[model samples]
Target: MEAFAVPGLPEFETGDDIATAIEAACDLRGDDVLCVASTIVSKVEGRTATLADYPAGPRAREIAARFEEQTGEERDPRFAQAVLEESTDLVMDEPFLLTETRFGHVGVNAGIDRSNTGGAELLLLPKRPSESARRIRERLSVDASVVVTDTSGRPFRHGQTGVAIGWAGMPASRDWRGETDRDGHELEVTVESVVDELAATANLVSGEGDDGTPAVVVRDWTFGDHEGSENLYRSVEGDFVRQALREWHYEQ
Candidate 1:
């Protein structure tokens, strides 16, 4: 499969037609998978905000003070408040704020991005990324799949890679369980995230800085004959790492 960014896109703004802008920039085929950076998605969805919007309360001030005490770098209490407002649970409160967004995605600062924020002080993630993808998919003229992507630092990795936060018109994973390998060993638990793969491919061309290409079209990739699953995020009850983090947080 080949992926290329849609060129000549203007800096998007609130209420900009993402489907129209993409269709104007490139001719997408029905079989293609369209990957969109969450930046542009947040832009069109009007998720911009400023530090003034979130007044720092006692909890936010405490969190910021603790972070400052540990890192020796002062953090804005308003920023902490913004993170808290966007999150349903705070996974970590020291050194950095690791929190779970209301929509179930977990990330630092509840995914309230400051870089490339379309000139806003903060660019919040889409309220519901999956629904955002679905809306974009429905507006498209072709029968293409859509994946909303974000740059995410992996647990044990040094740098960040693209991860799918929202997807439409396709299952999240290609289930490989019970399938036979070359040596005839049945696959017990192998699920491939096609959306994340596509997102990474798109990011390869999308670039991190000033490329201005936030949307990419991936062509000629097929899921093949395989079972699909939509289970991606894990609940707190079953997520050992999250539980461990919580335990550590309380222990501190």
Candidate 2:
């Protein structure tokens, strides 16, 4: 697979479409997956809030509230967004994982950032990345996949790596249960996330380092038709309220 880093992208603004940039970077006939960082999408959508404009505490509170409203669940009331990268369980100076947001998006800074942006403009995750990807695919009129990526922290890791929080035109999870390997050994339940792998590969070129690039197109790969991230969410029956009760009762 070949990855090409797209350079010379300007500070994106609200309503600034990426159709042209994406088209120029793509090889519509060849097999390729366009991996875009959430930060650039956020910039294009103008998803920033000025910390200087509003008082820090108030701004943070408002952001937290908005996150809760968007995610339909309670989050850390004091959580603040920033720009930072993470390493992995065995490697230092490696950007292999992404952080998870309260909304279950795993990417860098929980898909938030402040660096390389306009004054006081903090970047956020795309409002609807899967939808965005679908739209881009339609615009290009090609047989390519799109992935919106972010950084995430692992279970036993001290740092973070990249992951696909949103994907279109690709299967984030491939179920290999009951299937056979080369030796006809029944694959005892192995689910692979191709989207995350694509994102990590793209990140190799579009690093947080001084590459000055935020997007990449990965060529030569076979992927499934586009689904979405909506179904990926785990169903929350009634656990949240119970957890709240546990905390409240303990306090009492």
Candidate 3:
């Protein structure tokens, strides 16, 4: 698959839109997948946070205090929590809280970004990436797939990598369950997260610094005309966390 890097997208104007920026960047002649950094979308839509306007230092300190108080852990968990807040989507739940973005991404943070953006404001995940993608598809007159990505901390990895929080016009996952592997044994259940893979691929070009690139286009992706970004999320019946935590607690 060929990836084209689009650099230095201008700030959005009132009437300015994602499709216009895309048209200016590349010739997306029908049937291509476009991957966008969530930061860019946030910047364009003016979704930013101002720590200076508030007592950020004191707030951070308070956060640190509250976290320690709750968990009764000595270390400052709230420092991590505050950083997480900068990147998380706050979700209200019973007893404990659950944080996840609209794209079915779950974590302590919602993928909010404080890095880059000229230090003016923190960048948030796209408001509604799938909707944004749909709009872009309609305007471009092409068979397009839109993916809005944000950097996320991995479970066992050192740093961060991009993940899909919102998508449109693309297959979110590729299932390979009940299929034969190299050993020719039937696979029980396994699904590849195509959207996350695409995000990682796009990140090769959209580096952290102001490299001037915010988007990438994949030209050789195999996609059907009617396919869109769905079928990516698994259903949750009851207290998935409780079951997992129970297993983990026993394993410990």
Which candidate should be chosen as best, given TM-score against the real structure?
1
lDDT of 1 by residue, 96-146 (tens): 888998878889888889989889999999999999999999999999999
* Model 3 TM-score, all chains together: 0.72
**lDDT digits (tens) for residues 1-252 of candidate 2:** 678877677666677677567666544443578788877777777777654433436544655576566667664433342322111111110122133344455344455566756554666566677877777666665777778877656554687676777777766777666668888888775666778878888877887765667778887677544323334533334335323433342110
Give the whole-model CA lDDT for all candidates, comma-separated.
Answer: 0.91, 0.60, 0.64
Whose TM-score is higher: candidate 1's or candidate 2's? 1
Give Cα distance to truth, residue 226, candidate 3, Å: 13
Per-residue lDDT, model 1, residue 124, is 97
User: Which digits, one per residue and each the tens of the lDDT, describe model 3 over residues 107-169?
Assistant: 444565667664555555666776766666677757778888777774456897877777876
TM-score for every candidate vs. truth?
0.97, 0.69, 0.72
Model 1 residue pairs with clashes: none
Query: Looking at model 2, which ten-residue stretch has the lowest summed lDDT?
Result: 85-94
Span of ten consecutive residues with least summed lDDT in model 1 = 243-252
Q: Per-residue error at 184 for model 3, in Å?
A: 4.7
Count residue pairs with overlapping backbones in model 1: 0
